[model samples]
Target: VRTVVDLGGVTFMDSSGLGAIIATYRSAQDSNGWIRIAAPTEPVLRVMQIIGLDTIIDCYPSSEQALNAAEQ
Candidate 1:
């Protein structure tokens, strides 16, 4: 299974959001699934980078691309 999280509408994200994403990633891994972020706003992307999440999670330019990658 795969999950695509859309962050285009998000204006900002704090530690809580990062934590939630990490938890989801862990859960997906445990379930033999994958999780990716799609079109995150600049602010959110910056936060992810600061926390080193960008290197771990698959970040796509768009949700469609993420979904397609998950299928493969």
Candidate 2:
């Protein structure tokens, strides 16, 4: 269950949104799967970086890159 979330059009996100992602990430890990986030806006990216989400999950500049990484 490899997932790649596209955030190219997302401008804002709150704790609930972050929680959803974290939940999915945990689920993926539990299933021997993975998740990636792509094209996050500056604000969202900053929040993720501040909270170290980027360290735990892979983030890419584009969905294509994310999917490519998932392939490898």
Candidate 2: worst-modelled 10 consecutive residues by lDDT:
1-10
Q: What does the lDDT come to for candidate 2?
A: 0.94
Shift in Å, residue 32, candidate 1: 0.9
lDDT of 1 by residue, 1-72 (tens): 468999989989988988889999999999999899999999899989988899999899899999998888
Q: Each model's C-alpha lDDT? A: 0.91, 0.94
Taking all chains together, each candidate's TM-score versus the true structure is 0.94, 0.97
What's the distance in Å from true for residue 6, model 1? 0.5
With a 3 Å backbone cut-off (N, CA, C), the pairs that clash in candidate 1 are: none
Show model 2 residue runs off by greater than 4 Å: none
